[model samples]
Target chain A: MRISELSERSGLPVQTIKFYIREGLLPKGVNSAATRAEYDETHLERLRLIRALREAGDLPVAAIRRVITALEDPGIGLHDLFGTAAYAIGPRVEEPGDDPAWRAARREVDALLEELGWRVTEEAPARTVLAQAFVALRRLGFTPSPAALRPYAQAAAALAEHETGQLREDTTRAQALRMLAATVVYDQVLVALHRLAQEDASARRFGAS
Target chain B: MRISELSERSGLPVQTIKFYIREGLLPKGVNSAATRAEYDETHLERLRLIRALREAGDLPVAAIRRVITALEDPGIGLHDLFGTAAYAIGPRVEEPGDDPAWRAARREVDALLEELGWRVTEEAPARTVLAQAFVALRRLGFTPSPAALRPYAQAAAALAEHETGQLREDTTRAQALRMLAATVVYDQVLVALHRLAQEDASARRFGAS
Candidate 1:
């Protein structure tokens, strides 16, 4: 089909479609001339998946490219794909590790998490995220104290671990661990866990929870 | 006290304290001429809070600044202050009303939740995340197909909502309801529920069901 037909069917604008092509996100159809290109079902299907990961999964472009590449490779696990993407766009802003105060604050947060009896893992980008946040905020003139973060980080770490651990307790759907790894580790850490909190508050007396 | 003394007490480094003073993230302390700034417990408390928000909450500097400002305000509720920060960081990349694909994905995911007999919401930023992923990927070299996504989006929505609901149904975490809101949402959606499947699988294979 022509790009216009593809656009109408996909519900995306022609200009946007062109942007996708230019970004190298979309494959070019057989070209009869300089001005003409043909697209097929492969393009349509790929576009749909792109929309799904981008819109539903909240993946960034660079991350999305990595995910697509991984998905196409057939050898990579889904968990790895998600981990790369989750860390790719960067989480919040991180502080530079070169600074001593930032390092102190980072260590404090970790110590508190440990204090809470939650097993903290280095697997997720929590450390990276914290590091970058400091750097970004410092750039914007914000300083963090280890004292303020200790309890909060511990509490959050405990809660996050609790939430993640709930997976191990459920007695059904246990066989799907592989599928769950990518979906849960990435989604829960990146967005879903927080969403639960947001819903609670909106419903609270405050107005939106 | 000396910078090192303050560092020992506050658990921050002398250098970082200087950076904070320079960056204005921390207020300048009593100066011993132009050579030094003194910090006290108050500064330490403030710094701790800043780190917690940045690391555990993963809040952006701009958002963290707003939170700090609010935290310092006399009239704001403490609960509300934290709640608002969570909302500010939000789901997805957080630009509202700009991405069609994102919105559509949100609606689709919400619909998926509904189909799975779970209480679904329209306010989720998960959709936005998915949308951003699309835009991001399109910026790269791969355009995902809709057929590839429609089913997965639907399945994720259904599975997440259903799984979490089931987990909550059996437990009496009386506050699980509140737990759902005051924390991140996706964690429970993906993590807690996935645990159920894993648990059941473990039971079926490792022990007598």
Candidate 2:
């Protein structure tokens, strides 16, 4: 197919498609003739993935490139690939200078991880992410009790079991990539759902109207 | 106390405190004399809450103002105050036209809400948020089964019950405002924890090393 056809099929502008090719986000098509290259099914699929990551997942171009690179690397396992994508797009937590509040929060996070017996790396960005939240909570004078966070951990474990279960049965790399993308992006959805559920529960118990 | 004292206590720059006062996010201190104003403990508390909402919750100034206004309203109940904050910070899901994928996704969201017997309003931003995730999933060619979403809903409900339970025992309007701020900001924490837990579970099940 021609660039125009690829653009029509992918619902992207032809100029934007060319830009992606220039940025190495999409591959250049074969030069069948002068000034004209023919694309294939792979181009269409890649374009769709790129669009989903950019628009739906809100990933920056560099992060999307890292994800794509991981997907292309046969040496990377499924778990590592997922981790790569998550690390590339996850929130960044600035180092909290040596404040007592931050120190206490870090201790609490360490305790929670030990109690859960989970195997996340010490260097995982998520450790910092959780620690930052704790610091913020303490600064606001509201520390979450261990009992309160336990249900969230249990829920996360249950969801992770389900997610990993689905990944184990994958048939092709393309399918695996799709599943990984959905998994990472869906976290945002999960948070929204939780907030909505809170509203519903609040309405049931204390809504004025 | 004066503006400098309020600034020191709140850990905010005097200029930033003045900016918040100017923006109506914080109330102005009393005019003590020329080139000076008197700030009380209430000013310090409000400043802290404003900073928490801005930095931890990532709420816009306008949204924070709305939350503050709700908190100040004598007629507003605890539930309504929470609703105001949640509605203010929830993700906005723009209509995705009439694509079959989107229509199907919207129906799925509607059905899921019904099955859960949740009482979310029709205009709740979360409904659109869930629908958008479903649409993105289908576009990526991976439709999540109801079984997969059930655990998430159950977890959300459990967390919400815990959150609302705490508010029930709150003593004063000031305390309630602080609780609402914590609840809203902690959602970010919950998400980070969930991601960290998923990584742990993944490492246990499929770690390369």
Candidate 3:
């Protein structure tokens, strides 16, 4: 297929697709003439993956490139490849600042994760994000107890199980791309659903007819 | 207590506290002298709420003022006030674009919510958010079925239940502030936890020693 068809089918502009190819985010199509190149289903799939990461995951070009590079790396196994992609689609945290409150929150988050017996690594950016939320809550004079956090963790674990359970004997590249996209996009979906659910519960309890 | 004391307690600079006062996000302190005003616990609490909304909720000053206005309104019930604040905090989505994919995604999300029997309003910002995520997913060649979405909704509902359950007989002002802050911060926390759990699951399955 021509680049124009790829652009139309992917709903991306020809220039943007050209730019992606230029950025090495997509490979050049097989050259059929001086200026003409032929694209195929792989290009279409890659374009779809790129668009999903950019639009839904809000991942930067650099991160997308990293995930692509990892996808092409035959040395990395399935789990580690997924890990690389997960880390790339980041709520990537800066190092925890040297504030007593932050340190305290970090310790609390670590303790809770340990208590839950979840095997998240120290370097997982989500740990910093979780700690930061705790600090914010505490600043507002509400320290969420481990007991308070338990339900959230439980829900997270269950949702994670459901997400991973979807993976089957699919091709590695396709599965990784799908999983990567789902991880980022579903995070947004879950947030929206939670807010909607909260609104419903508030209406039921607080009388907003 | 003085403005400086409020600043010290809330960890906001004195100038920012004064700015909040000037912006009407906080009421003026009682005048005690020509050059000074007396502050109290209410001021401290308001400052805490302001900081939480700004730092954790990422709410703009305008939105913060809207929340503050709702908080001060005598007629709005607890639920409505919460709805106002929740709307103000926002994953406030733009209206869906005039694209077939987005419209289709919106219908799918609306149907899923109906199937789940949740009493969320049609105007809920989260509805748009959920639809947008679905569109993004579909753009990548995946449309999530309600079956795939059910666990996420279940988790969201359970977490919402836990959050609302915490609102037992606290003063209206304090409870509303706490809930608003939680609604925003917890969304971030939940995203982080889900990612961490995914990493753990990936590690366990994919030979990531």
Candidate 4:
């Protein structure tokens, strides 16, 4: 197939495909003449894999080259290739269903934020955080079954949304938001603050002892 | 305060604090004498900020230095500082509370898997898919409240947990785990895959119908 056909089949652009070839991520085709050349199934498969690596994995082109090269090595096993591919995908989890229990938890969290006088971002969700954590967890050897972590996911989402809303406060909008808030790195500041509050508050009301 | 006091208060070891100073992430203290230096609240505040940038924001020392320098410029506005800090942390929002949602999502996802008669993962959470998504979302933006994301988190966790368990079936345990499951760079792959899926899936499920 021509470069356009390859792009259509692989869902990549001809320019990108050409760039990949120029960047050595893709090997040049066998010399048919000075300007034109022929490609084979190997090229198509390689192109698809490259698209997979680039689009889904967000890998740098250099890394993609190394991945494809490694996969092409006949000495490697199929398991290794797929596993690498999976790793390359990084995190592969998603929400399994739309359930009421999940919604109830969100409602409870929303209410807590309201009671605490916080701005609630209704559309905020925690799936994104799970994605980053998934990459770390996958690295840690726990594939994590959904049954084990659903509660955490839901709770986490609410927590993150509520917390960020704090950053966006407009009470002192005339002054830059940075001045009203501590100039400390936002994540650590809130995480440490929340944790300290959680520990002290929980102990005060429902002492572990 | 002495370095020891600073370390204790900030929960950072003295050596790391010293490293931060050496790396220019922290401002130098005024000299108390020819050989010693005196530190104070300004130093403490800076150290806390440093910790936040490194851990939550994952800013490299060089990048953190750049952010600080940018913010120090009197001509620069608060909005620019915020954007600079965000870039330093990596091109993503550092929203908190994402983990719990993922954990919750992982839980419910498993129950659904059992209902479907899918071989559930012992190590992976059904929310594995969501877990991956969380990482992605964080990379994209880190603001979802943990509680709000519960359902999405749990469901994705369940799905991923189920998908991940299948890896073992394809190859030797050691090989699969090492090549695909263990490599840190697998994130490189998973990130790409998730993105590809997102583009296609969103088009299929949410595009104009």
Candidate 5:
């Protein structure tokens, strides 16, 4: 297939394909003649993966590059590859500034993690994200008690267990990457669904009609 | 209190407070003289609420204005106020193009909603969000079966139920708005916790050391 054919099949512009090649996100095709090259199934597959990462996962080119490297490395186990993808997709949370509210929020987050007995690292970006939420809530004069946060944690843990149960050892690299992309993108979907569900519940409990 | 004092207490800049006043997101302080005005505790409280909506809820000024209006409307019931806030925070999802894949995804979403017996409106932005997720999954060659989405919906519904149970009828308007802001912002917190939980589950099941 030529670049034009690749563009048509992948629904990406030719310039984008060229840009990806230049950025080392995609490989240059084999030169069949002067100014013309032939692409293969691998190119098409890679283009599809790139599209999924960009559109669905919303990952930057650098993160996608890391994922590609992890996929191609024989020594990177499946679990490790999943971890890399997870890290790439998680938002970068900045260090909290020194404030009484932030300090209290950080303490609350540390306690939640300890109580949950989750074996996540101290530097996990998720820790910062949780702390930020607590800080914001406290700033608004609504400190969520440990009792309020426990159910959410249990629900999250249940979903996580289900997500991990879906993974298998025999999954191919492309499939694994696709699964990871879906996992990250579906967080947005889950939030959306949760909001709708809240509306439904609110209506049942309070709606007039 | 003066504008400078309000800014100092709220941790907002004088310019931003002025902008909010000019934009009608905040009411102007009582005119004490030709060039100066006197603010009170109400101004400070409104400024704090605006900050919470902007920083925590990530709501646009327009949405925040709607929320303020709903809060000020004495006739609006507590449930109606929550509904207004929920509608304000839901993301606007663009309609997917007319493709076979999108059509299939939309049908799947419809079926899931019907199966769950959720009472969401037809034009709910979350409907489009769920459809978009399905389309993305299908495009990536990983169509999630109803079996896969069921647990997610269940988890989401459980969280929603827990969230609603926390609301009380005697809550003040400011407290209600704070609850809504916390609810909107806490989605990020929930996703972070979910990711961490997944890591824990993966480590326990697949970790080498």
Candidate 6:
């Protein structure tokens, strides 16, 4: 297909497709003439992945580039592929300063993880992310106890297990791409679901009419 | 207490505190002299809340302002106050255009919600948010089934129940503010925990060494 058809099929403007090619987000189409180029199914697939990551996962262009780079590496294992994509797109937590309160919060998070026996790396960004929430909660006069966070952790664990159960050892590139898309997009799904559940919980408690 | 003391107590820079006041996120202090103003415990508490919402919740200034405005309304019921803050600071979903794929995904999401019997408003932003994720996932070649989503919803409902259980009928202003802060900050907590759990799941499945 020509660039025009590619643009029409992808529902992206021709100028936007050209801009993506210019920005190295999409590979240049095969040159068919001096000014005309032909695109293929790969271009369409890539565009879909880019759109999903940008719109649903809310990943920045640079982060999407990192994920694409990881996906393109044929030698990368499934675990490493998922890890790279996750690290590229997951919410970031700024490193905490040496405040006693922040330190206490960090220790509490570490303790909670240990108590749960969750095998996350010591350098996992989620540790600091959890600690930051703890610090903020404590500042607002609610120090969330480990007991309080356990249900959330257990739920997360069960959900993660179910998600990973869908993965297979001998995955094709296309299948891997689909999984990668699911991995990022499902985060938004879980977030929305949690909010909806909160509304439901509130309705039950307060008598929604 | 002076502005500088408020800054010290809140641990926010003096300029940032002034900026917050200018932005109407924080109320102005009492005028004491030609160029100086005296702040009190209210200012300190507001500063803490603002910092938590900004840093932990990642809410923009305008959203924080809306939350603060809602919080300041003395006659607002607890449920209404929570709804206001949630609408103000929750992740926003862009309304979809009249695309068939989007409509299909939206219908599927509506069905899932109905099947779950979750009592959410028709206009809940989370509905659109969930539909968007479903659309993105489908574009990437994974149609998430309602059965697959049930466990996630159940987990979210249980967690929401535990969280709402912390609220009381005769809450103080401080407690309400704390709950508001919790409402925003715990979203980040759940996200981080989910990612950490994913890491653990990946490690177990792929044999992380």
Once model 5 is optimally superposed onto the true structure by TM-score, how far is the C-alpha of residue A65 displaced, in angstroms? Answer: 3.1
Candidate 2, residue B16: Cα displacement in angstroms equals 6.0
lDDT of 1 at A178: 24
- Ranking of models by TM-score: 3, 5, 2, 6, 1, 4
lDDT score for residue B108 of model 3? 92
**Residues B153-190 of candidate 1: C-alpha lDDT, one tens digit per residue:** 34344333443443333432222222222233223223
| Model 3: lDDT of residue A204 | 81
lDDT of 3 by residue, B26-94 (tens): 889999999999999888878877777776568889888888888888897788888777777778778
In order, the Cα lDDT scores of the candidates are 0.48, 0.77, 0.81, 0.45, 0.79, 0.77
Clashing pairs in 2: none
Candidate 4 is scored at a TM of 0.30
Query: Cα deviation in Å at residue A159, candidate 5?
Result: 1.6
Mind giving the per-residue lDDT tens digits that candidate 4 earns over B1-209?
Answer: 77778888777788888888888778777788887777887677566555555554565778778766875676754334433553344323332455776565345445544443433233322134334343433332233345534333343343333334444444432232222212222222222223233322323332333
Error of 2 at B147 (Å): 4.3
**In model 5, which runs have C-alpha deviations exceeding 4 angstroms?**
A1-47, A96-104, B1-48, B56-62, B96-107
Interface-residue RMSD per candidate? 11.1, 2.1, 1.4, 18.2, 1.7, 2.3
Candidate 2 lDDT over residue span B131-190, tens digit each: 888876666666666777877777788888876777655356666556665765577777
TM-score of chain A of each: 0.48, 0.83, 0.89, 0.42, 0.83, 0.79
- Candidate 6 residue-wise lDDT at B202: 79
- By TM-score, the best candidate is 3
Candidate 3 chain A, which ten residues in sequence have the lowest lDDT sum? A170-179
Write model 6 residue lDDT over B1-209, tens digit each, in one string: 98888877887899999899889988898889988898988787788777766764578888888777878887765666667666655677787679887788888888998999988878887888888888777666676898877778878888888878877767655455556557667777877888888888877777457
Candidate 1 CAPRI grade: incorrect
Q: Write the per-residue lDDT of candidate 2 for residues A55-165, one digit (tens) a residue.
A: 645788888888888888899986787688667656658766887877787788888889888887777777788888887777787666688677767777777777667
**TM-score of each predicted structure versus truth:** 0.40, 0.77, 0.87, 0.30, 0.80, 0.72
Question: Which pairs clash in the backbone of model 5?
Answer: none
Error of 4 at B128 (Å): 29
